[model samples]
Target: MMKSSATHYGSIAQFFHWCTAILVLVAFMYGPGGPEHRVYSPVHEFDRRLHETLGLSVCALTFVRLLWRTIYTRPEVPPASRLMVAMATAVQWMLYLLLLALPMTAVIGAWLEGHSVTLVAGWEIPPLFATSHDVGGAIASIHKWLGDAIMWLAGLHAFAALFHHVILKDEVLITMLPSWLTMGRARTGR
Candidate 1:
């Protein structure tokens, strides 16, 4: 049950998928948005640290997920248009790329701006790069844009899954659902 079968994703892959989604959402919520002064201000310190911690966790989990994907077989794609398949693959990779890039940009921008990368439990990573406020500001702006992009793309992904479940009446969404949930759905003829 830990490895994906031809018809469904494994429990492990499901766990990684849902957990990463939750972490990304929570991190986005905690992010201290606004100008640099406001973001690094003492008033937003806890939120900032929590956001960084979650972002870093997402980055690490993404790497593990990639490793898991390589080692385990994923469910075969259900019947769909070639365009749909291509879009799904593109979205998947974009999500992975965003997962890695978001945290890296945060760390790099903070370092370039001469700010410490603070995390939970008072852990801090001091600036490693030479101070370049202008460039750091630019990167930080991009990070914000990327954060918004991820949320929108994730929403689209969810919509596509729902489209498959309700409109297309396919197994695409069910394949990602927990076994118990899917079993209940089957029993109810839903």
Candidate 2:
């Protein structure tokens, strides 16, 4: 059950997929910086903590997912047009790259700025340097820009999956759904 079968994703793969998706969404919502941030408020504090912890979790999960993926082949999706299949494959690759790159950039950016990633489990990652914030500003800028781009791409990925389900009337989306939900379902929505 841990390794994905030819027919559908295994439980572990599904778990990682959904968890990473949710974490990325939460992080994006709390990701804004500068003037948008309130210096001292519960919401702001919550945002900071959530972003830090969730980002870290995403990074860690991505590694596990990648390792699992490399060792195991993904489930065989139902037949679809070559174009659609290629599109899906490209989007997946982009997402995986983003999953790895974004968090690292953000983490290194924070470190360069002399800040610690206060992990939720009661540990803090120290800064990479003591007093050199020279590259922090640039890295921070890239982080924001790349973050926006990745969110847009994620939206497109979701839209494409829905397109395959609702418009194309395929199980491309269903196969990825949890077993309990996909039991008798043909596709997403009506």
Candidate 3:
């Protein structure tokens, strides 16, 4: 019999999922410590560029992932309590929205700051708006807070996945685990 839903996400989805996670973690670690300690120096500039590059990469990956999701069905996770399912669905959608909004905000902020955004290998993305320090600062603040929210959401997501895997002994978490890591038993029919 044919499966009703995917057993595990394909390689491309898994790749983007893990890569985005790592990039987000790195971005958080590199962001300004606090408002009082904000300093514009060479090192800070380098970090900002790196952060921008990663953010752009994330935006590209998110677009591709969204397109893929539109074309393909997601794997079916085992049933959970209604409350748990609803919460998980909400979190998932929020993550998706963040993935879309965060990078666009960063790009807009960069343009407002009179900085050119260079993609990997030095390809420049033309600015979409005129330079405005005040606007840039405001967008920067929003970007930072959104990033902080993502970090908290990621923690919650990881905790919930672990709970389903370890505490509930459900396939919810395993279904997303890479096949090699899960010893090829992660798949569930439909």
Q: What are the models' TM-scores?
A: 0.98, 0.86, 0.84
TM-score order, best first, reads: 1, 2, 3
Give Cα distance to truth, residue 178, candidate 2, Å.
1.0
Preferred candidate (lDDT higher): 1 or 3: 1
Could you say which candidate leads in lDDT?
Answer: 1
What C-alpha lDDT values do all the predictions have?
Answer: 0.95, 0.79, 0.75
Q: List, residue by residue over 1-190, the lDDT tens digit for candidate 3.
A: 1111566777666777888899888866765434412524544666666677788778888888778778777888567789988999999989988887888877787678776775546577777767897887788678878888888998999999999878988778766766687864536332
**Candidate 2 accuracy as TM-score:** 0.86
TM-score winner: 1
The sequence of per-residue lDDT tens digits that candidate 2 reaches over residues 11-115 is: 888899899999999899886466322412446766676788888889999999999888887888688879878888899999999898888888887777776
Off by more than 4 A, model 2: 35-43, 186-190
- Residue 45 shift from truth in candidate 2, angstroms: 3.5
Worst 10 residues of 2 by lDDT: 34-43
Q: How well does candidate 2 score on lDDT at residue 58?
A: 91
Task: Return model 2's CA RMSD, one decimal.
Answer: 3.1
Clashing pairs in 2: none
